[model samples]
Target: MTVGSRRGQATESLRQLTEAVRTESSDGARLVANIADNPICRVTVDTGIPCVVLAWGSYATSAQLRFVHECALDLLRRHALHKILGDDSALAVIPVDDQGWLREDWFPRALEAGLKAAASKCPNGFFGKQSVANVMSGAPVGITVRSFEQLDEAKAWLQTVKI
Candidate 1:
């Protein structure tokens, strides 16, 4: 897809919510940690030069979701540093589901839990709902979503995203 081209509605919407700030590059390597505001609290991990939607989605509860969303800024800071330190590693992406965000008054707790799971499994790139569920279910690493209609875009983005 061309830059600025609108393809998938969800992907496009997520992109619109993200704002890139403070980009850094050294020796052909790039690091960007940007603040993203979406329907849910989110941290996008689009480093490694491929640009992936590392983390997206908001929590269900407004208050807790807001708190988690706010915390995403902090998370971004840490994520940036992590990427800077771990050069040549793939990014991780975690897209929380809307149901989890809405049905539970546990967004903050869930976010913390989810973030921990994602970070641990970040060695593996990309995660879908099932993968995330499994991580929450006690797996060491989050599951990776293996199928997508737009496989090329999905994979390309997945490579740059970290949970």
Candidate 2:
């Protein structure tokens, strides 16, 4: 099959997976968006707070990274979120190429789109820590970035952010 056909098939598969995992409000959080397949990330709006929760899967490719960014951007546009709680504890490795794109391109766009504060739960291993470090180092001004080992702490910190 051609590359375009392969891409189309992949997209369809992701759509199906997203649909399978999609859920509405549960325990006060509302599902806003999700991207499945390679990266498998979901965005949910906290009904009790002005924050968005981003949960990432274990493995991710460059395409998945782009899709995650797109989904996050859409969520930002739809909700007036003051903080983002990024649960990257499952993320293992991020391709070096994708790292640069995230720092240089996606993050700037997110900041411009009104992302104010972000708290992330990072994986414990070297690769995951390094990936988070790279993105944190390159993050633009005006947004606060913090790393946490526990999801509860991350959420608590996000609550303290003024926006």
Which model scores highest in TM-score? 2
Error of 2 at 140 (Å): 0.4
- TM-score of model 1 vs. true structure: 0.22
The total number of steric clashes, by the backbone 3 Å criterion, in model 2 comes to 0
Q: After superposition on all CA atoms, how large is the RMSD of candidate 2?
A: 8.5
- True-structure RMSD, every candidate: 15.0, 8.5
lDDT of each: 0.33, 0.70
How far out, in Å, is residue 43 in model 2? 2.0
Q: What is the TM-score of each candidate against the true structure?
A: 0.22, 0.74
Model 2 poorest 10 in a row by lDDT? 23-32
